[model samples]
Target: QQQVKQSPQSLIVQKGGISIINCAYENTAFDYFPWYQQFPGKGPALLIAIRPDVSEKKEGRFTISFNKSAKQFSLHIMDSQPGDSATYFCAASYSTSGSRLTFGEGTQLTVNP
Candidate 1:
């Protein structure tokens, strides 16, 4: 898909809790799926990624569940911590297109201690 749209715009999760967010896209041609985490004044870093070839992917406490038929995906942050507070973005692109991603509107997550 070309554009990924995310919801809520922000989230507040308690420490040791789980945070969930959703996203949908418009294009099915996209193959690479990546979630990026960014703090204030910092560039987004790739947190985790999965391809349409896979149903899910996880990295440490971060996980991404993708649904190809639905053209949707989600980011799950487990055991939320204050240090996990940041802005998260869901992104998708294709290697055939040189990995240029169309990012979501972004969700600001704050984990309370």
Candidate 2:
């Protein structure tokens, strides 16, 4: 079974603050971890990702901190802005699965000015 459990159904962050969302997976077969950001009336977009081999990954203000032993990962948004407000989903996938991904419930993040 491919499933990812994410915490905090919703979140509110102030402008310039850090916003964090966490997720955990039960399937150890997952090799790739990615976070997706979705805005209203639009499709989800790839935010950041990490592999089992790496402990963390950062792209601009977005960062993915992963723990292989714990099978857990988190997304951190630095200097959160109102424009960054969106629904985030954490997903796991393996090479054998092709583009198929198992995503978490989803987290709604609101960055207030």
Candidate 3:
């Protein structure tokens, strides 16, 4: 079973616009929610994260909106720029799992100048 599902397999946004990617998961044991951004030739890097206690978390231009009850979450990029173009993955993991994460299918984002 695909524990997590992401929508809009690809997205195109203009510079200065908002880029949004959504994800839904089936597991309720998950506590750590994180988003990762990956460039073509580099590994995915942690962008931002949130715990179930909070509904949202923001870091600079990246924000993660989470809904614990609904088992859903989303990543929003404000003032998106060409440099922000990359593949984004939403992931969840429980403490018992250590560093292992259940990831959603990545969303490919392209920001136009």
Best by TM-score: 3
Off by over 4 Å in 2: none
Query: Model 2, 28-113: lDDT tens per residue?
Result: 89999999999999999988889999998999999999999988999999999999999999999998888689999999999999
Best of the two (1, 2) by TM-score = 2
Q: Positional deviation of 46 in candidate 2, in angstroms? A: 0.6
Query: Between which residue pairs do clashes occur in model 2?
Result: none
Per-residue lDDT tens digits of candidate 1, residues 1-113?
A: 33788976999999999999899988888988888899999999989888898888888888889888899999998999999999999988987888888899899999999
Candidate 3: RMSD over Cα atoms?
Answer: 0.7
> What TM-score does model 3 achieve against the real structure?
0.97
Per-residue lDDT of 1-113 in model 3, one digit per residue for the tens? Answer: 99999988999999999999999999898999899999999999999999999999989988899998899999999999999999999999999988699999999999999
Measured over all alpha carbons after superposition, the RMSD of each candidate to the real structure, in angstroms, is: 1.5, 1.1, 0.7
**Clash totals, every prediction:** 1, 0, 0
- Per-candidate Cα lDDT values, in order, are 0.90, 0.94, 0.94
Better of 1 and 2 by lDDT: 2
- Ranking of all predicted structures according to lDDT, beginning with the best and ending with the worst: 3, 2, 1
Candidate 1 residue spans exceeding 4 A from truth:
none
Q: Estimate each model's TM-score.
A: 0.94, 0.96, 0.97
